[model samples]
Target: MNKIKNIHILILLIFLISIGQMSQTIYVPSIFNIAKELKVNMEEVQKLMSGYLLCYGISQLIYGPISDKVGRKPVILVGMMIFILSTFLILFANSLELMIILFSIQGLGTGVGGVMARTLPRDIFLNYENLKKANGFLNMGILVSPLIAPLIGGIISNLFEWRMCFVFLLIIGILISTTIFIFLPETCTKKQIKNSIFGYKILIYKKKFNYYLLILTSGLSGIVVFESNSGVLLSEMGFSNIEVSILFILPIPSIFFGSWYIGFSKKSFNYLMWKSVILCLLSGFFMWLPGWFKIMKIWTILIPASLFFFSAGMLFPLATTGAMIPCKGSAGTAGALLGGIQNIGSSFIAFISTFLPKNGQFSIGMITFIIGVIIFLCWWKLSRLEKI
Candidate 1:
């Protein structure tokens, strides 16, 4: 019975991770066509993305504490159900305003998955190495969805309509929720549950956890910056939706490779973290590289995208582990707080990146590089603390 219980929890974790991946991945390609259909400016549509993400980030604080009290299974299922309903609304959405509202609701669902998925493994797997391995799997699952989103979105939009993209999300959500309902067991113990909701405030006060949180949150800035800028920048450079889709896939292989590399290594130190930061700097350099020589081409943009994605893959797991390691008995709160910072910081990055000049590829590249460097400085500060 004990052995069976462990298997059930592991499967549940994987399923939740997949759902988390699906929620984020399903919307990327549809953004372009959806904006056209809604008859709103692209920036208005972009605000929808920002709204979902910010809400998703903020909801982590609420869900994390609630899950610790109510039990993981109930919180997760409620989140999944909400997500399914939101996706359905998005499928039939007619106006830009409606889509934005539904997307924010969708953010709530995705936010729950994000917090629970991270917290579940930390609850089940105690050691630093095992925890890192579980996180690697979670990250891998999230990355998998993006790998296919562009292609799937392209085909569906071409054959039927952009609305089908949400329809596809509905199908995926139903299947995932059903699997969780049947197979997933509650992982939290009664004693491990928080005595009060205010426990999260105590956890956040820890010095070590706060530094790591800064790194995890800042690292995500690059992703948001890129997402907010990519469609506009790529279109200006003569890439169509399909062409952008193909270019988007360029980074998946590199990301997968980075995750695999991190997983296989036994060492978990500041060195690997620095390597990720350096790669991010290089990615920024590559983004500006073509523009520097005045020879902007399709490959120039694609290559930098590939580099940035890979660097992100390398940094995320390490930073996550660093943040959670200090929490001791508060995995749920730690996961929630970490995820909150990531999404909130990302929302800010996406919003700020919008202010950059649209015509300059170098501007995007430089902005990406600056974000990477800021994360690196956070990493450096954390390293100094570890030494002391």
Candidate 2:
């Protein structure tokens, strides 16, 4: 019965995490439609993503420490309510400014789930192997959002309107909130610390934690750079919203395969980490090569990008588990720092991509290559340190 109950908890946690992530990319296919309807430019529409990501990251900082003091369930419930309300209000937003504000608020609410989703696994699963399996399943499940969100958003926007995307999100928010209130239990059993900064200070001083954090951050930022730019780049290539959305699905399977492979294989984490680093470097080089030669076809982008995603699939679960293991005493704060900083890093990358030359293929490829280099250097540093 306890095992069955744990399975239920894992499923619910996956759902909670998915809703937060789906909110980020669900409107991607609707970017052009949103710009057309709102009388804004592409850059302005892109700000909506950056704005949401910024708040998503910032809100985690608050939710993490508070959830440590309070229980996970209440903090998550409050955040879901905020998300649902904001998503509903977004339907009525007629201007870009208002839309941005509401979307950011939506991100703020989802940030609760972000911190809790990761923290709960640590709280409930005491065994390192169990935690690793939980994280593997969690990440594989979360990857589904990116796979389908754009397709669903495109179909919805193509049939109805861009605002309908929020209608869908609002519904998801309500459902997730209901499940949390009914099903999720208080997983944080540790005595609450009076000063939240105590956790932060300890984690910040740990060399392994810092290195793992950078490895996670740089890898995720590369993906964000691709996601932030891909919609516009594909749209400009004369693909319809539906077609572009279909194309977005291409790289996801690689992620699934990578995650599954890592779970079943008996390879050492250090071996997998090195293999992922090599894949990332090669992925970056391929992503850049096609653009450098003036080839800008969709395949040119998708093929190499798929390789990058595959590398991420291998890297993310390992890095996340590595970063959190030592900080188990402060799981909530550690989760907040991990999720918050990565999102912020992605946001910064996305924001910077906006200023790059509009030759979408070249700019995106170059940025990805740079990100690959960053990951390599971080991994090199991490390899020299004591293994986690």
Q: Clashes per prediction?
A: 0, 0
The 10-residue segment with the lowest total lDDT in model 1: 19-28
lDDT of 1 at 306: 78
Question: Superposing all C-alpha atoms, what RMSD in Å does each candidate have to the true structure?
Answer: 2.3, 1.5
Highest TM-score among the candidates is held by which one?
2
* Candidate 2: residue 174 lDDT (0-100): 90
Candidate 1: regions farther than 4 A off: 1-11, 193-195, 289-295
> In candidate 2, where is summed lDDT lowest over 10 consecutive residues?
189-198
TM-score between candidate 2 and the true structure: 0.97
User: For candidate 1, what is the TM-score?
Assistant: 0.92
Global lDDT of each model? 0.74, 0.84
